[model samples]
Target: MHKSRTNFVFGEGDKNASLLLIGEAPGAQEDLEGRPFVGRSGKLLDKILKAIDRDRFNDTYICNILKCRPPENRNPSLSEIDECKPYLNHQIKLINPKLIVTLGLVAASTLLGKDSSLKDMRNNIFYYMNYPVLVTYHPAFLLRSPSFKRNAWEDFKRIRDYIKD
Candidate 1:
């Protein structure tokens, strides 16, 4: 199913790494660029990653739940997520990361098997497929709600702590 959608980005890191970042489907910019986190939200995400001392182009492997961009930047439907999930599962298995960081509600809800606000999701570590998973607010959400950034900073600090130790 994902084969026909050429816009999706997929892969593990180039070498041994223990952390994986999974996001929701691509946006228009990401679809066009063939990379995850390449637009405005991506810019903010880069800042956040830098704050935590992690870089997507180097230490972290990034991918989406769905490879293709949904029409009009809308949320991907249940069937889309269901169809593309196996690929994500496979990537996780291959990477064998010690930790998985799920960005935003849709990605976290799908991976963690629960529907909740980012507020409810952050600051705690969960488990998925036996790997430690951390949940955090999406950069887009922080763009909309700048007041929440301090909270996100705390969450990123937690991730750094885990990665460092």
Candidate 2:
């Protein structure tokens, strides 16, 4: 699906990290920079990680379910996701993370192979390829709905504690 794309936002951060964060897809800034989480949402994510003493460059790997940005930042279609699933699977295999955090519903659904609300998915643990998976709101969502930042912070704290263990 991304073969004809000009820029491909591949995975970043510590390749050897035991923690991995997966977002839905890249945005305009990420598409331009060929990196994931480089926009406003990216900035927020950085702060959230810093609060828990986990830096993307040092402690975790970050990527998205889709390599190419969907037009106008719309959600990725099912066919697009299907095409990109293998790449994400390969990334998970290579990173071999002990825990995986899925940001937002699209990512959680894609990774978990089911559709469910964020409320139903959060504050709990699931598994993907035997790796523990945690669901959380995307930074973009938190940006739009600042009211949920508290919940997101709680989730991040859990992630921090899990990593420490």
Candidate 3:
């Protein structure tokens, strides 16, 4: 399904970062640039991180659940997610971050292994491979639903509270 993808988008940031952020998949800008979260959503993410006094490149590592862009930028199917799981898992193992944050439903469900609503997942800490995991609205979702920015801010604050530096 991702055969036409231009880049693998294997992810980027400090390998030793204590924070690992996972999104659903690469979008158009991310695919073209071969970097995760480099589009409008990324810009918003930067602001979000800045609000909590975090930096994308220097502080937290960022990547997507699926490294490649799905066709038509559509949601990734189950088979595709299954195929990409190993790579993401390896990343998690290598990063060994103290905290893991899933930015959307796909990523959260992938880690938590449940189909709960983002609403249900928020403010709750789940575990992935012994690391604490948090779930929040994707930057894309926050952009579309500005009202939820408050909720996202709360989630980010939770992160800020944990990684006090």
The TM-scores of all predictions, comma-separated, are 0.91, 0.96, 0.97
Q: What is the C-alpha lDDT of each candidate?
A: 0.82, 0.92, 0.91
Candidate 1 off by > 4 Å: 1-6, 11-15
In candidate 1, what are the lDDT values of residues 32-141, reduced to their tens digit? 77888888988998888888877776677878898888877789899999998888888888888778999889999999998778788787889998999999888888
Q: Is candidate 1 or candidate 3 better by TM-score?
A: 3
Highest lDDT: give the candidate number.
Answer: 2
| All candidates in order of lDDT, best leading | 2, 3, 1
Tens digit per residue, CA lDDT, model 2, 30-105 = 9889999999999999999999988889869999999998886788999999999999999999999989999999
State the lDDT at 114 in candidate 2. 75
TM-score of 1: 0.91
Structure candidate 2, residue pairs in collision: none
| Collision count for each candidate, in order | 1, 0, 0
In candidate 1, the residue pairs with backbone N, CA or C atoms under 3 Å apart (3 or more residues apart, or in different chains) clash, namely: 8-67
lDDT of 3 at 95: 93
